[model samples]
Target: MDGQEGKATRKGPGAPRRNWRLYGVTAVGLAVVCGVAAAVGQVVRAGEASAVEAPKYAVGSGGGTKLDLPVRPTVPVTLTVYEDPRSPQSRAFAQRYAATFSHLLASGQLQINYRLVTQSDKQYGGSGAKEAAAAAACAEDQGRFAQFMDQVWQHQPAPANDALKDRNLLTGLAKKAGKINHDAFTLCVDRGQRNGWVAQSQSEFAAAGLGEAPVVQINGRPLPVPPAQLTPAELTSLVSDEAQRVATAATP
Candidate 1:
């Protein structure tokens, strides 16, 4: 059943695929901004005049109203990760490598753009994935995207079919992110403020020619991982080495 964004336990290379047509959510506009999101208009890349909306998960100091990539230039690596919340592989990888990623994030050695693929909802025959994705988008609105992600992956529902549509579960996950304003975050989740964007993210991901979730690209190039090592510690090492490699290559 490891088809398209599912666990790679029983699939040949590239056998898995996303049935985007069935997902039925429209993708949002693409923005390559530096920081997260906010309730009002957000800060964009300096001197940028486009009306492009702020990225939902922009990292910044002012509760996501501002978009600033943390840390600095010793290592410049951009990691564009496309993931589906219901995908076992995606959850495994995120939690398995959380420490390493957090370190890189803190050091400003890595620039990360998380692309969500809610199409797993259709592929897996449930709305759990899509709803969880919308919850994630709500978390981003509260400037706690990364934090909420960790909790969701850490406490991932078992059985693959267990729905993530439980409001109580989602709220608990959001609280782990920080001192969140529960009322606002809850309302955002209930209303799905970023549902359209959630849909559009998958569309943009496909448009970029990345065929599936749990896909990682470094500097716009695919960062290949053998299916065998999907959960090995070596996965994190590879990412670390790639960050260094990109930094070294950019050096004068």
Candidate 2:
């Protein structure tokens, strides 16, 4: 997937397979980042030239003049995450915070939906990465997107590595996630039908000026800087504050 901007092509064999050791490295990184997201509200500032529009979700809230996600005070907030399977940062975020998000979901505090992007391969050299995106989409057909995403994030390989694209790995992860039929998952990956969804997500990311992984949007607006970078405590506070805002707004 490696090519210069505007001259990229999606053609090549997948990268080498990763050993189990890589998983350990990713796990450690996720732990550290999770702690950061929990203790500090750290987010990378958008580049001055990032060209991202004021996200649709931020158009009306007094905080930034953006409309908030139309969430009912009694219902959990739904967060949509744009991610790339080949990106380590995305994996780390998923590993560290997905469970917390799940807790909020169960408690009616938050909900989440994920959109997988496959554009990195064109810049990073993991041509097969798109395959992973397709596989996850296929898993979604079986109502297994959440399970598939958890596996992908838990076992995400380094960028430019094709290990994440292996059919066996995808199937193994799906099986581990308890997909009802490994054969169905395998068939889906082999057929490559879901690549369109990946392409659409990539297009959306590009239009949004999100050139990397782990782009998070609360409701429809991008999270402010501190929370964007997964600063633990800061993110927690922000979520709490936003939740309160949503709740108060709902009161008579």
The prediction achieving the highest TM-score against the true structure is 2
- Candidate 2 lDDT, tens digit per residue, 1-252? 335633533222222235446877899999999998866543344444454556564445456545455545473466778777887777878777866776667766776778888777887886556888888888888998888878877778778677877788888888878844777778778888887778888887788886577877776777887234666666666667778877888789
lDDT (Cα, 0-100) at 34 in candidate 2: 93
What's the TM-score of every candidate structure? 0.63, 0.65
Minimum summed lDDT over a 10-residue window in model 2 is located at: 8-17
Error of 2 at 218 (Å): 1.3
Error of 2 at 159 (Å): 1.6
Q: Each candidate's lDDT (Cα)?
A: 0.73, 0.73
Encode model 1's per-residue lDDT on 179-228: one tens digit a residue.
67899998988887878988888777767776656887777877676432
- The TM-score between candidate 2 and the true structure equals 0.65
Q: Weakest 10 consecutive residues, lDDT, candidate 1?
A: 26-35
Give the Å error, residue 158, model 1: 2.9
